[model samples]
Target: MNYTLHQLEIFRTIAQLQSVTKASEQLFLTQPAVSIQLKNFQDQFNLPLFEVVGRKLYITEFGEEISETAFKILEQVQSIKYKSAIFEGKIAGKLNISIVSTAKYTMPFFLSDFINANETVSLTMNVTNKMAVLRSLENNECDFAMVSTIPKKLKIERIELMKNKLYLIANRDFNSTKKKILLKDLNTNLFIFREPGSATRLAMEQYLIEHRVTIRKKMELTSNEAVKQAIIAGLGISIMPVIGIKNELQNGDLQIIDIKGLPIETNWNLIWLKSKNLSLVAKAFKNHIELKKEAIIQQHFSWFNDSN
Candidate 1:
């Protein structure tokens, strides 16, 4: 009750950096000034916030708990400021979005102009697997989730963003001629795959099963980047989105493995819970996407059509 918001902010910064010196540098204050404020703040608590050990600082258990509380408090304060601005006829707030790893290449293009136009709108984007993206949406933790595999169980509304094509790919050296191979022929090669919960892996599994092709061995990776690296290293061939591998494909480091009935198609969409109310910022983002999605596709994903 006795601590000021300024002190909480200062304490959070110190706890985060673990060093009064670094916190002072980041906050543009003298080290002594930071140390004094830290001392004043620490005087209120019996437990030490952080410790200096051999030139490095460590946050204590209590420090982490208090730091988390301080973060929530700051976030709430930011929401209040944004709410006030909205009442004054402004669209200024946080826009939290979680996207599948492959959507990273696409979402930013859609976000660019909207972000530039609304300088006050803040964006928090998390690029993770489809499982985590859906989990965040299910828990209502984020404003929107950009994913290709739409969930069957969740009650959600979606705006189609772009077509997602997953192609069987490999190191350029592995397919020198890029000759089309039958699905049965691929069973001989080792395959790299995204983790089980990944939508990309699910699509690959469906395609392989539909053709009755079975592999004997596989290596699993957790992200598009890791899977792409494995493929580029010739560790194995795997299905991956073209957007994530454009540079590799363009530079001849990797190549699409030609196969009959290849390039598993999916649609990328920005989905949110149908039951959830959209925030002003979130609504603005949706509106922006609805209005400019076509232009964004033309500018950023023209290669998608060209490749087809």
Candidate 2:
């Protein structure tokens, strides 16, 4: 390899810390030395990796791609180093994890419990949408990801973590003539939805398609919080993760419809690269969730009328 591992390491550090000085301190090198290493790595790519303006370094477009690739390269190198260290028997490293946004509500509690139990380890979490979570996992940007959507043909191992049910929620102001709502009844009603590529949105779409329900165009939103706000303001109904809307339902800001025979089921899975050697932290997390999956699901979804 023409590019030195040190060069890739410096680039990765700068990308993460976003400052040469911070990268230098973390790596225990002088700022000028860090700058020199970054420049050398940029030269290897034949492109300026970062743009400096008024003492602030912003990663360029191409730099972001390089930084992502460099992250994977450096992480693989670290795994090798960790293996070598394990020959002497030691365990230490931060485990980086990412999860889709809708899955965020429960992840913190479980993750905190795990971290508290494992004093020798720490974790970094990236809360993003489905596409970003997939991208992060594919680029080795994260060690593992908890996501609702599993892509076809991706070389990843997935362990079912939990089955989450979907709920059609609306504000009290939503006045429907029918007692039991049907998919076709929502045609005239306003609809609030997660942006394209959201698994919840996809599931809802698939259900509508399968039932041959024609939906009127309404609002498209990105976050569950935004969808909740719109629903609370009487904008429309939405198909949302039951876990995500528990507080709203309890507060009476939202009401779940007893829509019989509608598509109401989904699952969350823990995903990781099949080809990449699994880290101890990642394996532990996967095992922990697998073992406790049933209890967690029961605790969360027990109150629902539809127990299945």
Candidate 3:
């Protein structure tokens, strides 16, 4: 079979995702291009690789074996590239990080300098909720994780990068006749929340418990962007990291509510399992963050002072 490496890579992605649309999205290729390439690859093999039943794609038994082979081949090819780079004495390899979704708003600033300095290093950042990110870290699926809430169950080493400040936010049209808004005053059902297992949600819940805050009405959204939009739509107020809502605040679409106890703060942290051995690339990346994070913060996040 005269199959190209591109065809092998595309086949691996399709096998893993089980959908042409999803594979195309992940590969940043058009759906039709993915479909055509898939057909061309399948034409080389006599046995069917995949089948569609009830509008769902299913890999054939032989297809599963081929997919595994494809995965190993791609992995070996990548290893060869990394070995070549190492022989040249270059700081090169992949850096995989699992991060709480909100960290997507700020962690790039902390990573920018190192990433720019090491042009050959590949970065894969998986942004998800805190629980999922922690799970990834616990499974050793990533080199590091960026989070605000430190986990108790893991023995980890961490560098505190910056402060994550969460404030009670409302749409600009939200009524605020009183100068001093008490937690008890927000006793209505007009509260919105991030989904449970979110670090921000946990922080909000902790503050609510401390102040005995209660809301008669509440709804849940799974992402920072969603919660921000819900608030902008005047659906309800929510506690969100200031970093995630900067543009909205600047645009006057949202306003911060200064209640008796507000702006719950936590340190943004980069953490890794203490027991895991670090690769040269991971160690170099860690060193870069530890050394230059302060300058990066000061340069990119100076507006944080005014965001408050």
Best by TM-score: 3
lDDT of each: 0.87, 0.79, 0.89
> Top model by lDDT, which number?
3
lDDT by residue for model 1 over 1-308, one digit each (tens)?
Answer: 48777778888998887778889998999989888887888888999888888988898999899889988998898888877877888889988999988888899999999999887788999999888999999999999999998899999999998899988898978854636677777877898888978889899888888888889888998988899888888899998888888889899999887787778888999999999899878999999999999998998889996786
Tens-digit lDDT track of model 2 for 1-308: 38887888888889888999999999999999988878777777667788999989988889889889988987787667666655656554568889988778767755665677665565789987888888888899888888887778588988877667787888876765678886667898887878887887888877777778777767899898899899999888888887777777778878877786543776778888898687777777777777776776567656642533
Cα shift from native, residue 97, model 1 (Å):
1.3
TM-score to native of every candidate shown:
0.84, 0.68, 0.92
TM-score of 2: 0.68
Query: Which scores higher on lDDT, 1 or 3?
Result: 3
Looking at candidate 3, the ten consecutive residues that score lowest on lDDT are 299-308
Clashes of each: 0, 0, 1
- Rank all candidate structures by their TM-score, best first, as comma-separated numbers: 3, 1, 2
Tens-digit per-residue lDDT, 140-212, candidate 3: 9999999998999999999999889989899999878888787777888478888989998888888898888
Q: What is the C-alpha RMSD of each candidate to the true structure, in Å?
A: 3.8, 7.4, 2.0
